[model samples]
Target: MAGNTEPLSPRAKLAVTAGKAAAAVSRAAGRGSGSVIGGRVALKLDPDLLARVAAHLDVVLVSATNGKTTTTRLIAEALRAAGPVVSNALGANMPAGITSALAGGSDARYGVIEVDEKYLAGVARDVDPKAIALLNLSRDQLDRAAETRMLAEKWREGLAGSKALIVANCDDPLIAWAASSSANVVWVAAGQEWKDDAWSCPSCGGVLQRRDDDWGCGDCGFRRPTPQWALSGDYVLDPHGAAWPIRLQLPGRANKSNATMSAAVAAAFGVAPQIGLERMWDVTAVAGRYDVVSFDNRDLRLLLAKNPAGWLETFSLIDPAPAPVVLSVNARGADGTDTSWLWDVDYTRLTGHPLFVVGDRKLDLAVRLEVAGQSFRVCENLDEAVAAAPAGRIEVIANYTAFQDLRRRVGN
Candidate 1:
């Protein structure tokens, strides 16, 4: 019932009511949260429901290959300092789920939406947000999602004349190229650890020249832009050259980078960097991610990594060697039908750790690890994997469906 005070047209009102009822039914049936189903029904009832519901709110759209969900949560937390904020706290970034979230929070003063990489342009068009946060992009869901450059080009074409202030990561060449067409952009130096997908310039098909953190193309003038905001170690440097410490409950540098981007977006909405960071400190986990579940007297920390780029970032978050690691992979529709991305991850980095593989695509993962010259045990299920590990803290990394399955099994 939390929605715009202004009266919606009869059709719109009915659509919203129907969506809510459907969502309630879905939850009652114990299927899922019903965000997607509810939104789909609402859209079928009214095609323009998203724009109508979000019309009164100051919306912020967040899009990235990875970290969009976490970044959206962080931005929402920061925005709450200003007023009532609504967000898709879950990892639902597609149009249907996003529409459901907005409709549910129609009365909120702010809307922080996490958008799927491929749907960013369409969602941005509908929301007409006050700001758009462009995080780093890399290869993901090869069969389902577009290639990195194709996605970047879509972003460029989609965001061509938007009035929203673009908060972009200049450290990523694709991101730089995508946001370059925007008239208003606040570039941030959030580092990109996965460099494989971005070696070639998106603007011109030339090898990107790299020198430390700087990158440029000799064939084309496209280069890394000077960022007004930059992350250096544990601190975020603001546009005024003032250093603000990034203290968060989240683990790893990728999260720090996510925090930096969130703070930048929050700043665009008139919240101070310190206030945003302080608010974000309360978030220990996102959508069951980084959740530590106790199983068989062993502490299993859950981490989700769906692609090569995601796995690259996740490796750094794992507890050091000697602590057994559980890797789960699934090639379900949500995780893409292809498991070839498994080869791109450098399993050798886990050389000193005991490794266990589980899931529908465990064989693919095992093969990749074998080729990497890393020894691992293939487990039939998550319980077996956890039981096989020596009782202590263990790391559990999984793809989309696999992570959800393990989370459910662990009662998370």
Candidate 2:
């Protein structure tokens, strides 16, 4: 559900007017790429504007290393079943984008915001959301974000003080440790497809022991918390052990985990899990992610992978043996200046798929693929790469900026 576009208060009206004007000016001048500048202008006009807007709405704040946008969308859609809801639709997860979203939908009673993993604590403090969904915490933007343990500790501290109901993924040890201290916590057994970032225990500097689904620390008593809303074998298991059917248009177990966690959040707001799952079926493509578009007589499915964990999860959702797959990589500010993370991804899985590499860091990916005994063709231009690709449905997996560039090419 979408919120009212009109602002209600004089101060909010002034801020929104200025922000919208700035956004229009930025778009006209081609200076601003997303909703960031408008948010910046609004916050500059009123430093406490986010707090003020939040005071009138029931907020649901979502934060994660990945899947924040999609999770936010799920929660927003579920909440819309009750009434109008506002959310950050673009891949913007910073304070400015959040403020812009809150301001844009001032008439809405529910605000579902996707805050950046690094900025979660600060935004959570101001928004005081009814429920905070803490998805998996993993290594992302190593140059920008702090260590995973440090972030978990920060979350632990933030959740310790907030009265909000914490809906967290218990599969990740870091996320479990982070939300362990929250008074009102609803743990979800959302599967952590990648555990590379949480090999060690965040508490007592001990090695976390894993035995199938359970995890514990021998050095300390800390362990994986039992989930209340658990997902087991394609069904959402409630606290009472009742199984509920879970289906989604979104592919992969990661998305199923996202939906399970969102179902818990929706339940907290009086929406039934069945209703949430039903709504989730309607959201196939989110912000150009997992979007299949017809281009140049070919069907191209777009997927964004910013880090090794993301790449690992996204690669499993595609089948590229028949057609050539486009792998785009860029080392821009948004994509992380360090493309060294490419080495962490398992390019060997792409051996069967004819690889067409593009972007500024295409050569780096090409070398990695070659090292993995995979053959690749480097094309500087995506159009040219597509032209050379096998005539069929192609999967184009790209990093942050590269994914956005491809989205623009597909007219998203």
Candidate 3:
């Protein structure tokens, strides 16, 4: 409880120290290290602890900018279809977070950890997983992660000599480029289903032109690699069509990608893809990132939107023709670590009118909401926000820090 959950800034070293102490205690007990809310727990992880645990299971490291949690969560569930599975289920991609996950999963046969791009190198060396799934790279967290290109370069280097069976998303030009350089790669292309790959080519630095299923660089011929498996087919948007038809239950096109990418990773592990996918009975919405729950007899939807990519995707998941909607955002703790990233997000895409706003940083979110000319009602707290929410489904987009604190306060 004496740890610091600060951003990756001046308070990062303190976080590392707290992470080490907390880990050491968890290792000594040989059990899942419980979540610490107060600033009393320290997390100084024991190196020997991992060495002991690593001997029992084949670990899989899943890294990406957007879909790491969902994709890895899906894949870890899929792996369980084959046998017992282990994973860092609580979006703990950093070294200390992963250490806590491992300590928790001391008995698991396999581990699927969602490692952040920046933290991938350290985790790679620590866990040394047997498989890895590289979901995709996008622009996010400008304050924390500099640029997609820079992160990709670091990931490529970290994964340079990895022995894990690589399962990569071949849709993004940058990710596709990383997979090509990987030692053993089994690719999955997003194809015509995904949007916005109209940038430069990953191969020859040429401009890309979209052509149905493929996006190719006209000048140098860099195109999406032919994936081993694809989910490109047909869709009938009958106004009365099934919304939750897909077995995997996360909303939006990105969730579909996350689910399918997990299936592909399962196949690489020599298991039936479909069978593995079915094991994921439901989307694991633990805290933020689409965590739907009830509070005071009302449904509350909490999502983690860090940067432009996440904001755009979350916006995409919302139905434009719903019973209106409510949105709340905050940057109290780690949530609004650097509110500057708000500039990078594509707020224009959220044309879907919102009903209200809440959180400590509501003024900021309100200002943005106002600047974008979207309607919003402000509240001082989540309780007030929920109370103000219309008597129907409510939508909330709380960033990393806000989501956790909100969860505790709301008993989610």
* Number of the top-ranking candidate, with TM-score as the measure: 1
At residue 164, give the lDDT of candidate 2.
90
Each model's lDDT: 0.91, 0.85, 0.64
Model 2: residue 271 alpha-carbon error in angstroms: 0.3
Q: Which stretches of candidate 2 lie over 4 Å from their true place?
A: 1-12, 30-34
TM-score for all predictions? 0.98, 0.95, 0.80
Candidate order by decreasing lDDT = 1, 2, 3
| Model 3 weakest 10-residue run by lDDT | 235-244
Model 3 per-residue lDDT tens digits across residues 1-412: 0011222333433544565566567657754344331012323333333434445667788887777877777888778866777677777566656655654554567778788788877777766677778877776555667567667767777778878777777777777776666788877754323244327665566777876667667797767786775544321111122222236566777776677677777777776655665676566574356777888888877777665677777877765644445555565544435676565555666665556666666777777767776666787777776776666667777676666667777666
Q: lDDT per residue, candidate 1, 142-205, as tens digits?
A: 8988888999999999998998999999999999999999999999999999999999989989
Identify the candidate with maximal lDDT. Answer: 1
Ranking by TM-score: 1, 2, 3
Better of 2 and 3 by lDDT: 2
The ten-residue window of minimal lDDT in model 2 covers 1-10
